[model samples]
Target: MVTVNLGMLHYVIDHVYGAFMHRTKISPPFFSRGWGGSKLELLERLINQLFPDVEGQIWPPNLIQPMWKTVWESKNACLREGVFRTPCDEQLLNALPPESHYARVAFLTPKFVSPQNMACVVHLAGTGDHTFERRLRLGGPLLKENIATMVLESPFYGQRRPVLQRGAKLLCVSDLLLLGRATIEEARSLLHWLDSEAGFGKMGVCGLSMGQYILLLLLHF
Candidate 1:
């Protein structure tokens, strides 16, 4: 009899993925452009300024007011796809790629629930997640429990991916910082919209891998 260890299989798969991601001709390692001059400095300054505010009890004021429009919906209206502007402030907008200016989302809910009685969770993207499909599927099962899901399309991903960028590997370290900053701002604004505009009773956030870190940052404000 032969015994197979699943743990070893998992490591094998991970090794294969790592090789494809880092050693392939088509796939570029992250931060391929190295640390940029002005953008890197700007990111450092912003981080220093924001670090102190994270400890404060008061949440930061919402700056983005996204006007959402339904792009697609199931025939029964139980699920829908929507999009809106990323709600990036002027300073952040200037630093982002033109293609990443808008944000996309997928909203899932049960048909009979009212917004006031339901809970909604905003799902952030992981390192390589470029679409709402995976997150939406993960949240779909909760519809029966009256919990809705909103999957956000991170900047530098999905329809927002920059033309020059390849896959999920960011071109520069500053781009990673920018992506994180933009995602946090957008998620916070979306939460505000869910509470004040959409009138959801309870709100929360969830993510996977890299997204988990972003979720933690969001909790600070």
Candidate 2:
């Protein structure tokens, strides 16, 4: 006969409970909101796309034409607000709606005074973001220091978010990835544009929350 001592009894109890028990059920766990089979398949595809072969040197994106559009002009600091746009990868574009205002960076820079060395910051925004609505206080000291600050309209942000979508809500999984791809590319495009622009003495990128997160990914690609 199998001998079950106190320690063995405890082990058996743990095994049985572990299979069908939660230590705490106060809040739903990660991925607890089960995505259906179709979404799961998309999740799989997303995984594959994200996890590319970990071999070979990372290649830079090809030259893309940047379309600049002025949205706001700040008299406080001679801020000339403009949008920086670059054509996204054709494949990525296919995923987005035709009218989708994707891959654009809203910027603020000094107009009258041209700095011999343009020190720029690629500032980013958080949720519920509107034009110049980011938490970061763009004007004042930085402008005084002659540091030009620009903000990239993140995926599903400002003009980039589809008009039909209405409000900023959690986008579908595919849309999320689509946003991510566009975002990384947009950051790359911005950097490329800065590099091409003449009189680019020094450039810096800064952000909060989502912005901060992308910087990590930006350097990797």
Candidate 3:
């Protein structure tokens, strides 16, 4: 008789699935462009300047106010889709690919709840998560708790993905760093909007996998 470890089997299955899905010939491997020379240098300089041997020293000097354009609304007005320009600083903005300049967001809330009576949580993306649909569905059940979900479409995925890049595989190593920095800036701005402009009583940020790492970095500020 052969005994198989269920956990190990499960891990093997996951890896096999991921390999087929993400490592195919049609799907380019990440960092195909190698370590981007100038871009990597710029990022390193920025990091050193921001940190300077001090913990939690990095923070956005100003949050750009989002000018939202509504894309859609549920008939009951509980779900809405909107987009705004990414609130990254000029230096970071110039570094980003053109398509990633704008950010898309989806809001899911319980109808008839006042902003002060409800809470909103901004959801960040895991690796390769390209759309708001998955996050929206995950958040939908929380409506019963009067918690609203704000799903952010990350740069380098969905409509923001660079044209030359294949699927979620970034073209350069520096692009990964760029994506994280841009996401933090955008998320901070969105949280500011929720607190100051929308007047939500309570707010939070959450993410999965890579997004969780980004959330940890966001906490530094």
The lowest-lDDT stretch of 10 consecutive residues in candidate 1 is 55-64
lDDT-superior candidate, 1 or 2:
1
125-161: candidate 2 lDDT, tens digit per residue:
5555645644336544677677777677766666666
Give the Cα lDDT of each candidate.
0.80, 0.60, 0.83
Over 4 Å off, model 3: 1-13, 17-26, 38-43, 49-77
Compute the lDDT of residue 28 as modeled in candidate 2.
32
The per-residue C-alpha lDDT of model 1 at residue 133 equals 84
Which is the winner by TM-score between candidate 1 and candidate 2? 1
Q: Order of candidates by TM-score, top first? A: 1, 3, 2
Q: Which candidate should be chosen as best, given TM-score against the real structure? A: 1
Task: Report RMSD (Å) for each prediction in the order shown.
Answer: 2.9, 12.1, 3.9
Please provide, for model 3 over 172-215, each residue's C-alpha lDDT reduced to its tens digit, 9 standing for 90 to 100: 87788888888987888888888877889899999999899999
- Please give each candidate's TM-score: 0.86, 0.68, 0.83
